[model samples]
Target: MYKVRMRFSKKDFMIFISHLDLARVMERALRRADVPLCFTQGFNPHPKISFATALALGVSSDGEYVDIEIEEKIDLNILKEKINKELPEGIHIIQCQYIDVKSKPLMAVIEYSTYIVRCVLADDVNEDKLNALIKDFMKNKEIIIHKIVKKKNKTREKEINIRPFIRNLELLNKEDCNCIFKMTLATGSKGNLKPEVLIEQLKDRMKISILLDSIRVHRLGLYSIKDERLIEPLEIGR
Candidate 1:
């Protein structure tokens, strides 16, 4: 058996598709393309395909990965072309390659993700106030937020500090009264921080009204943390 890794992009209307549906779509495409996919052994067999990370709903990503096991080796370029023709619009394969099956899984190695957030400001809001709010937010060493935790048969609210999960934040641009920002935050099983939570806290702390419904968030890339350095998932095996 051979292992193949594929990097893909999810954008446009495909952003609304859930992770489960995306997997199904990929499986169908692979079958239509006639790729030699391996299947699990059981009464009800399934393709041996898995995704590295599940992109949250309503969020678009340019960097997504999937691993598949096949029964035979094939020309990667031809495989990509065939699959691309079978895939629907807004979902495209960017790159593909063979990888060591013994290496760590992509989900386990992901430690951080970078995102670009474009905030649609209210008519009365100004850039100076937004800048001041961001400055104030960075000044504090810890920002506490209440989260619901489940224990046994009961659920309770727990206070958690999100400062440690935030690695970097900066304003990218201001145009036509809209503010764009870039953020890098902890992700994966270790500790994950959602960008929406950060924005909610900022609005509360600064007492600024924003068009939360109009905000757009796009995930740029996911990375692995190693020795105080950020590494891309594709670099792990090489």
Candidate 2:
């Protein structure tokens, strides 16, 4: 039995680390932590770690995860303690559990996610305004955006629609006076949507601008759909 999984977060400040670099960091961390991890039997052996999905650079997450392979079955609680002692700030393993045969791993399991997009306001942005804008955007039968798909080459086409791409959507907050956004983003292995693409389009649609001010994006959770229903990653099905 050599399979395990972990979920953690990348806060605002540490969002600069790319997913690949983050993967390398975790590999080193595991080594330093001294867990008896299983490695692929090859000329150049490597840790059997698999990241479910990657968060784009400069973005934060609340529902990020990775799956790992260990040499043998061990106490998850003790393994967590040993790893936590070696993990750096902003990378805390919230849960460590045995792989369930009936359940899917993080990457394959995730179908959707929630995000909070924050920006500075030119004029006072309150709850009413936020709600109104998002409401208007949703009514759009087709929302066209410059889709950045492949890293090596970006495809530029004009006749695409975003309405079907989105699932449950909402806008949050207006009390603080600064522009804050709470939107549920469509994510998963099948078809994923990023909050930024929508935010950029929203900026165009509303004629709003985000200057030097930073937009803090937080991903709340990841859900999987099975039998036309949503399933929580860490939850045991009832």
Deviation of model 2 at 57, angstroms? 2.1
**Model 2, CA-based lDDT:** 0.72
Model 1 residue 115 lDDT? 94
Tens digits of per-residue lDDT for model 1 on 60-83?
A: 988888888899999999999999
Please, what are the lDDT tens digits per residue for candidate 2 over residues 10-53?
Answer: 87556888888888878888899888887888799888788766
* Candidate closest to the true structure, highest lDDT: 1
Query: What lDDT does the true structure give each of the candidates?
Result: 0.87, 0.72
Q: What is the TM-score of each candidate against the true structure?
A: 0.92, 0.84
Clashing pairs in 2: 127-174
Top candidate when judged by TM-score against the true structure: 1
Clashing pairs in 1: none
Indicate the worst ten consecutive residues by lDDT in candidate 2.
229-238
Candidate 2 regions exceeding 4 Å error are 101-105, 148-158, 207-213, 227-229, 236-238
- Counting clashing residue pairs in each candidate, in order, gives 0, 1
RMSD of each: 1.8, 3.1
